[model samples]
Target chain A: MAAAPAPPLPDFEPAGLLRVRQGFDLAAVDPRSTPGFDGGKDEGERLLAAEDEELSDLQERLFAQSRSGARDAVLLVLQAMDTAGKGGIVRHVIGSVEPQGVHHKAFKAPTAEERSHGFLWRIEKELPGPGMIGVFDRSHYEDVLVQRVRGLTPPAEIEQRYGLINEFEAKIAAGGTRILKVMLHISKQEQKERLQERLDRADKHWKYNPGDVNDRAYWDDYQHAYQIALERTSTDAAPWFVVPADRKWYARIAVQQLLIGVLADIDPQWPVADFDVEREKLRLAAS
Target chain B: MAAAPAPPLPDFEPAGLLRVRQGFDLAAVDPRSTPGFDGGKDEGERLLAAEDEELSDLQERLFAQSRSGARDAVLLVLQAMDTAGKGGIVRHVIGSVEPQGVHHKAFKAPTAEERSHGFLWRIEKELPGPGMIGVFDRSHYEDVLVQRVRGLTPPAEIEQRYGLINEFEAKIAAGGTRILKVMLHISKQEQKERLQERLDRADKHWKYNPGDVNDRAYWDDYQHAYQIALERTSTDAAPWFVVPADRKWYARIAVQQLLIGVLADIDPQWPVADFDVEREKLRLAAS
Candidate 1:
């Protein structure tokens, strides 16, 4: 009999395709393709459901380890255009785990006090403690993205932030935080559809912002800013993952998988009992 | 034929049974009773499941309103003895909603810097922004509860904190935050059972702090402190609710109901579109 045909290889590994490697070009990555995930939408949903239990378990262990004096954590930084499904990723992926272990900060327009200090001042206060899973929805990158695109900051200062961000992330990584930066890449066409959907539904009206249209006018500038940000800040300590976000399901699953991969690498274990277990058991039983 | 007798009213409406009223006595509340809720453990679980959709919807509306320039927000202050299920409330009740709208702060022992400032200074910084639900898993009340119980602060100063807390809460309440202060009341027997459970399970050993046992020795003192805190600070602006927390399911549902009630009261409305919808539709279609 002829030898059986070789088993087919799985589609793409999202970690590799999404990661910002040297000379990575943002324009080259298609926002609609599910690069590493071969499965269709149904498959992605199924995979996300399957990973829920593991994610919960890993998060609990990480929290337990932190309570036992471990200084390791995971920080997920999410940057995306309006209606690019940042909220969906937060709700579907991070929402699966215990809330006790997750720290989420949605950075909005800076306050007067925040503007007076260095951009990272407020951010440093929100870093996850040991054993935490921190999610930053539009983080320090905003200083470079919007400020650069809109000409709100001096060019020299904007350039300085890229270096500052890299050094800051490197210092935190050295302190045991596994940083995963994700940019949800949605096509302009997809964005128009989403924006239209927000307008079409009365219930979604509150989420619609007239300013978003103004921002859309500067789309090219924003994209160029993102390209420079990705090139400058995707260091070894904190790598950026350009997630193809046109399909909400694929983006959610890919982000979940990325988090799971980092957590598995950390492999937090439950701490051993500090007191004598047998003695405590006997004492408790007697009591 | 005689008409069937009407069903009896449920004794404990968690919203009413748990809310602090004038001359409230913490000692009178039974930690094990499911007040106003005629549900057993299974019923509590089912009710919680039933409320999940509404809770999520309310939170989303609150978040949407906040984003659309509504200043209204809800702040849930969780104060409990060790293992009283503060974490469980966060996970089961608040966790069901979109994480983007929930701000959770787990206040640990104060650092040297925090000690240098007034207690509320640190707390003021963490207050939920407009349109967010902030959960304090142990809050400024700690300054009174632990500090008073342990005599960490002078008696006169501890006495002064209640007035300061009320003033601070009033200031914020006037600014649009609706505060719900919940005190999880568990029986001494229940605490012992919980503490013993931690000691028995190796996986839970990390949560077993020997200091918790030491704290147990001061249970009566802590109760006395809580009684005073509840009596003094349970104002109309920011009332305290003492939920019988021995039943984890009941406490979680009750807290959820409390939050739902507040959001319902606020009645956040969807903002009208600032831009001309018809024009945007034509513009997007043409684009």
Candidate 2:
């Protein structure tokens, strides 16, 4: 009998379709397009569900290997506009894995103590340990994005931060950290609808901030800042993927697939036993 | 027509059935018994699944309330011997809720810096924020359990720690934080079986430490130390619940029910909007 042909791989590889390449224009990408994914929302959900067991298994191996002195990890940095569903990605995609292997930090405004140090000081403190995945909900990029848009720091200082971030990420990558930078790209109109929904429901009122409306007024400046930051910081060592996030389900699954792919590449294996297994088994049975 | 009679509540009330009461005897409590819960393994799984939605809703409300200046929070402290399924509870019970709303800290050995300070110093830094649920995988009780049994600390200092723990818990409770302490009680036989299985499986070797066998030799000493710690520290502000953990499913569901009951008691409500609703609706529509 003839050998069976290999099955086709899933069309969820995000590197080619979503990655920010040289001279990439953010304006050219459509926020509603589900690039490289032929599936609709239902298919996206199914694919994501199918990967749950594999994700859990891979994480367990990674954790086990770490205990045996493996130095490998993945850092997923999430940057998005308000109401762009960063929290949803965290809850749906990252939360499905083993919690012990996941380290998450949400960076809010810096304290007086943090401001006393360099911008990268806090970021350095939260890097994931060996054989773990670290998630930054809003990361060092915020120093360039918001600070640039609001003029919180000087123009020269803001420009300096892009170089600092690139260097910082390169150092981390050199230490066996695979950095996946995701920018959840949502249109201005979609943001308005989301904000309106928050206003329409009483339970969601707490999520709505009046300041978001003021921030919305600076949308053009923010977008410009994001464009420049992406251009300056997107490197081979740490690249950015602008995921179309208008469809929340698609965005979630795409991110999940990206993570699964990275982990598959790493291919963490279960460590071999150091002791004589047969002898230990006999001893255990007797004991 | 009269309304139908309300359904009976599930009998897995950890507060009543498992709480370490005055004059509590750990030796008398069977580690194999399911306490008030009459459920089998399948029933326990069903009940845990049923509580997922309610747990998520209550947590969202708590998170929302916190944004509006509500100071209420819940801290679930889990103390268990090795192989008693603390990781299982974290993944199954606590992982079902919003990741953003749940703060988890797994306390391992104290670092040199942490050992330099008082025991409570490291713990204070990891406490749950207002309107969040914090889960402590292993907690300050380790000072009494491991320290006393291993003779790591002086007897006088160990005696003083019980009082210190009570006072620390009381101080936290006074600041709108509700404390729920749970001790997963697994039988010695079950522990032996678990450790044996770990040794028999090559994949599980990373989790097995030869030191665990040495620790097993002091099992009775650890038990005696635990009994004293539970009896001395079980107070109105922070009570300890000793759930039979030989059955992992039952222990998980019991812990879930305990968390749900505490959240139900708090009954966090959504905050009213500070901004004008109708005006924003129109403005959003116009935009």
Candidate 3:
């Protein structure tokens, strides 16, 4: 019997294809579109498996460089609605690397103490240290996204947050942080099916939030909020990628490719030994 | 030709075989021995690969239970000599689960502020919240281990820490935390070979600490310190497991199995729905 041929790799890069540019229209993007990737589910998974090792190696080099006082770091900010696969990206993509080198935070609604300070106060505390890959499940953008959609903040106050976010990101970028902001874009229909699955499965009940269903009533409002947030805050220092996330596998692979691109660009090298190697070897032998 | 037959699984559980008992002799245990496991390198690696999925699932369930107000959590505390594979246990074993659910802390020398407070004060702040798996690369045990060996603290003060640790762990255990302490035991000859390999490889240079060779001068003192600490602190609430670490693959697999046993005993079930499932289904259909 003859062997089967190998599958072709995705030719285009997700970084260029998925990045939100000036006048980018969220309504125009089909949630089901795979963008740069042409593969089906099985092939997408296979490609991810192939890329995982390189991702692991690159992250280790970044971590190693940090120990020698290198300030370079990568911050991956993931913003999504319910059932949009933010948890999946964390588990499958960031989870591929050494957990010690990855700093992950999943932000929730503010507490009384957090609300007393500026919107970015809590976020500034959790930024990744040198050579670490920082992940934010949802971030400071909620000031404009949910707060704006629900009219929880004044119109003027919500409007000012965009420029403030840009300034904050520029400061972080100046400190040698490479920021990749991603918004997992899933359609209303897709979310309905996903939410329904949660309701149906006995094992998935804890994940089913009744508030998520109530949020569905304001679907168009949230989408408008997202479009405006994407337009005003996406800058050269921190660009947002609107990933079509209806196909769970496609979303994961695209985010992984984006992260791999960021690390490769940093091109971190292992730190050279500062001490004398021969002396250390002789010293060890004596011990 | 037919496919190769599957290898047989190891018969004994690592949890029982590796736990440190009363009057435990550190000198009698062989660093090269693979107790409760008859497998060689290839089989050990294969077994870890096979067990990885179950470990991940068990972790997810534990995380899920926490969402429903469950107080249960697991803490894995790792103590080891230099080049004894503490990093390997982290990357290969705990890294297999969701990074979000794993709260990992690698303690360095205490800062000036940390030094001013009691030693346990800093450790208390970093304990994992409900439904999380906390990993300490080097933990409270270091206060006794390194501090005792170097006489950094008064011998009278060092004597008090062991009782403090036991009381602290028992209080934590009463609050539904399962503590698994592991000491990665390696031979001094094996340490020399590992340290030499690090010095030879340019890529491994960053991991080579010159201070490690200095520490080896105090090897016998350190081992004696470990013996006393292990004997005093290994209680039923948080028993210490002394894992043979000369074989890296065996060490990784044994830790994984021990973690699996802990999670399985907890037997976290998927939480039942608090809201009406039928009404939610209908509401989703309307949306």
Candidate 4:
């Protein structure tokens, strides 16, 4: 069969078409036009369901292929605005692999010990072996995203660190790792509704941190920071796919597709054994 | 709905049943003799399905509840014989939670760095925090399983190590963390079939090792060791369940049940936020 055409991508506001497959139009996925899809609302759910099934099958193949030992390990770094479902995407995507073959590292606040060493010190040790996949829920990118938005580092230093991240990733690639970075971009109003949902339910109350709302107030700064990070860092080695986060399910499906693509390239196969010696012994016994 | 009684386990070899569920009767399960399932299999499968759905739901609920600052983390430890699907069970069971809320650490052969510390040193740091579910691919039990089967450690010292592990895990539980251990068991013929399948496929060539075969030679020794491990380690604080490995789907379902039972006991409800400031602001806006 001939190769199929790529999906069309959504229109970019400024630096859009992040994943830019042929037919997928992320640009047209405006929240106001179809806010909170329901059975009655029926906002193209049928279209997505058909496409998601195809992607899931492709993902299973990638999952199967990535087990080969010769291939480079796949590393996915997920960064999202608050309430953008970063954790949700991480769970759904990497959850299928053999856990031995899939390693997950969540980068939290820089530890006193971690701060004493180079930023990559703690991260490098956690890289997945050739037969495995490693995922960082919040990764080394935080050094750029959070540090930049909070002005933890000076402008000169921030500009310098971007180059540092690029070089660090280059070293990772040179050592046989494929990296896919995703940034979940949720809109302001969607954030409001999600936060409200948490507050409305007693079981979800703990998720609504007041500071998160304060952080949401600085949504514009965070977006600009994302823009710079994406512009400066998106490269052939590790391209950034800024997934639309308002529709959480779509974002998850998109991330899974990207991961399936990366893992398919890794070639996950089981190793064969040298059975000649045992075979000879068994033959001798039979005779 | 009324809670169902514990599900009836499948007919197992006396040894397998004894090692697994503690009290399975071979006579009761012999398909050649027994005319009917007695609703045991159906009930077990139903409970398994229920448990899977419940655990999947709980994973999301826990992820959101994590911000409540309650360290109600569930630590799942999979200990079993080779080809038992310890890794496979994990891949399918926790497949839904986002990677951020779930941390997977697979303890491999001790690196020079890991061996330098006390045996459990590398494992201790990787334990899950409150709100995060840490899935250990092969955990501290390796000190007991691999090292024993291979005669890597002296028999004299193995006894002390067992006590030490119990004490170590006990302390972890006492500190408010919950632990559930699943031991995956499969028949010898089934294991050989799985191995052969791996060898026949070029893609799976990376998984079969001469060493795994070497270890397979001592399948009886390993089985005895596992029986001991299950008998000794299945405590109230951290119980070990021997799961059937001939069917991977069943094992995943069983594991999800164990997790829901353990995590639910922690009563993983979200902590209500003291949202006085936001409520006052919203009221002012309304006024």
Point to the candidate with the largest TM-score.
Answer: 3
Candidate 4 vs. true structure, TM-score: 0.77
* Native RMSD of candidate 2 (Å): 4.8
**Candidate 2 lDDT by residue in tens digits, B112-148:** 9999999999999999999899999998999999999
Error of model 2, residue B48, in angstroms: 1.3
Write the candidate numbers in order of decreasing DockQ.
3, 4, 2, 1
Clash tally for model 3: 0
lDDT at position B193, candidate 2: 95
Q: State the C-alpha lDDT per candidate.
A: 0.89, 0.88, 0.93, 0.66
| Retained true contacts (fraction), each candidate | 0.58, 0.50, 0.87, 0.50
Local accuracy of candidate 3 as per-residue lDDT tens digits, A174-240: 9999999999999999999999999999989989999999999999999999999999989999999
Collision pairs in model 1? A12-A36, B12-B35, B12-B36, B13-B36
Top-down TM-score ranking:
3, 2, 1, 4
Which regions in candidate 1 have their CA more than 4 angstroms from the true location?
A1-13, A22-25, A109-126, A147-168, A224-228, A231-233, A278-287, B1-13, B67-69, B113-119, B154-157
Docking quality of model 4: it rates as acceptable
Candidate that scores best on lDDT: 3
Q: Per-residue lDDT for A1-287 in model 1, tens only?
A: 55555444344357988899889898998999998777787777777777888888998999898877899999999999999999999999999899878888999999999999999999999999999999999899999999999889999999899999999999999999999999999999999999899889988877777778878888888899999999999999999999999999999989998998899889999998878877766655544
Tell me how many clashing residue pairs each candidate has.
Answer: 4, 0, 0, 38
Give the Cα error of residue A178 in candidate 3, in Å: 0.7
Model 2 residue pairs with clashes: none
Given candidate 3, what's the lDDT at residue B165?
A: 98
